[model samples]
Target: MARPSQLSPIAEFARRHDPDRFLCALFAPPERRDALFALIAYNHELARAREAAKTPLIALMRLQWWRDAVAQAAEGLPARRHEVAAPLHAAIAAGALDPADLLALADAREVEAEEEGMPTREAFAAYLRGTAGGFAVAAGRLLGAAPALLPALQRAGAAYGLAGVLRSVRSLAGQGRCLLPQDALDATGLTPAAVVQAPEAARPVLAALAGESLATLDETRTTLRPLGRLAVAAALPAVLARRDLRRLSRGKTVSLDPRSLGDRLAVTLAGFTGRI
Candidate 1:
């Protein structure tokens, strides 16, 4: 089981390794940072596979590769021999995280590939549990959090995933798709086609999503630990996300502009100070 030399250098770039992602990594033990890096890199790779593929089926095939790699790694095999897989396989051996979670994650990504538009609430929840929540739960074990924390981690992951979907609504709409729940949009007299074409017209939907984010934040309060920096780290992004949604609720649409340097610094400071 020798290590593989193939590493994804691009994943080492600052954006994915940026403060927020690093913040997430903080939950993992310092000794296991390399493993977490490999995991996050693999997650990014799985996500980008769709973008690289000529067809959705290709994306699904790539996802299956990752799932198989996870299984192989869990069984004391070399996984893929890639540099990322080396430390990742070691982590799997050490942590005893089930390979099924990895398979679930890949399967959920495949769902995104097959679906033409944003998922309904139920489908989105299922995806969150399998994908983001799966990662958080795995990370929780690495962080030495008790197993009970898995539910809390899942809730936090779902909240974050929902916020991401809401934020991407504008861009998704431009692609002739809308991520908003049909029921919610219907109540507001908005159609998926209309939202994609006239995102500004979906103000009500955006507002509702903003409110939902707030509720999720409140619901996760009991999960916070006294000095749980990871909890703070996880919640900080939600705060910024809520702020963004509030802006959208006001009038402005979701834009592709990067978060400001000041904002990143603010988040960094808040993360260090545990002020979030």
Candidate 2:
């Protein structure tokens, strides 16, 4: 049997930043770990590509390549001939997943590729459901979660993903991109450009959205709790992290200072200790 390839540098960076994702993928079935990594690598690379593109058309074209690759992989041609193909190939062979899920993932990328700011709650939720939820559901299938568990897992994943997007406001704004839709800001009588220029003022709105997302995660956590040891082992840290971020946002601090790193790490550790 062939081993999956190593992650590209960019993908490796993404893994480091998203330790929660790395840990979750690690706890997944050994047979599926490589594929999950490959998926993460692809997502990270594609996001970089989209961010760096000079034009939405160019980014969209590149995303099409990944979308087609997923389709071909489902049909056994294994698009791009890279590592993500390994577990995906196996999952397809086992009839554990559908190509549509991968397509949905690609479609979500397509939305991001356009470089349009998220402007409304509906649009933001749609993006989350399609992009973040899509990846989680596909990865969960590979991890051997029954189809019945997918909905709850997806809800949890979307909440987690939303938290990430909110946390990334500072980072993304530096890159000349913003994911918080313009419409939502407009409704608040704030221009999308203004929010991009001054995200601090948007803290209350962002915090409220983050709270809603965490609530969804709470529901997801409750559903998974009865499922036993596997559920707790896989999701507790992320749940704790989300909850911590939610609580931290209540302060609506003016700055996400470096000093906060200790607090974030503490939440992660406490969650790991089951004191969460």
Judging by lDDT against the true structure, name the best candidate: 2
Model 2 TM-score relative to the real fold: 0.78
Residue 94 in model 1: shift from native, Å?
Answer: 3.5
lDDT for model 1, please: 0.61
lDDT of candidate model 2 versus the reference: 0.62
Score residue 180 of candidate 1 by CA lDDT. Answer: 69
| Lowest summed lDDT window (length 10), candidate 1 | 1-10
Please report how far candidate 1 places residue 221 from its true position, in Å.
Answer: 3.2
lDDT of 1 by residue, 1-276 (tens): 012233234235313434355544553344555555656666666656666777778888888878778888877776576755665576678773556655666777776676444446676567666766666665555555566666776666556566566667777665555656666777888777888788778877777766766666665645644425644544445445555655655655655566767556656665666554
**TM-scores of all models?**
0.78, 0.78
Extract clashing residue pairs from model 2.
118-181, 118-182, 119-181, 119-182, 119-183, 119-184
Which tens-of-lDDT digit does each residue in 90-151 have in candidate 2? Answer: 55555655677767787787777655567578988888877667777776665556667678
Runs with alpha carbons beyond 4 Å of true place in candidate 2: 1-17, 78-97, 228-241, 252-276
Instruction: Give the Cα lDDT of each candidate.
Output: 0.61, 0.62
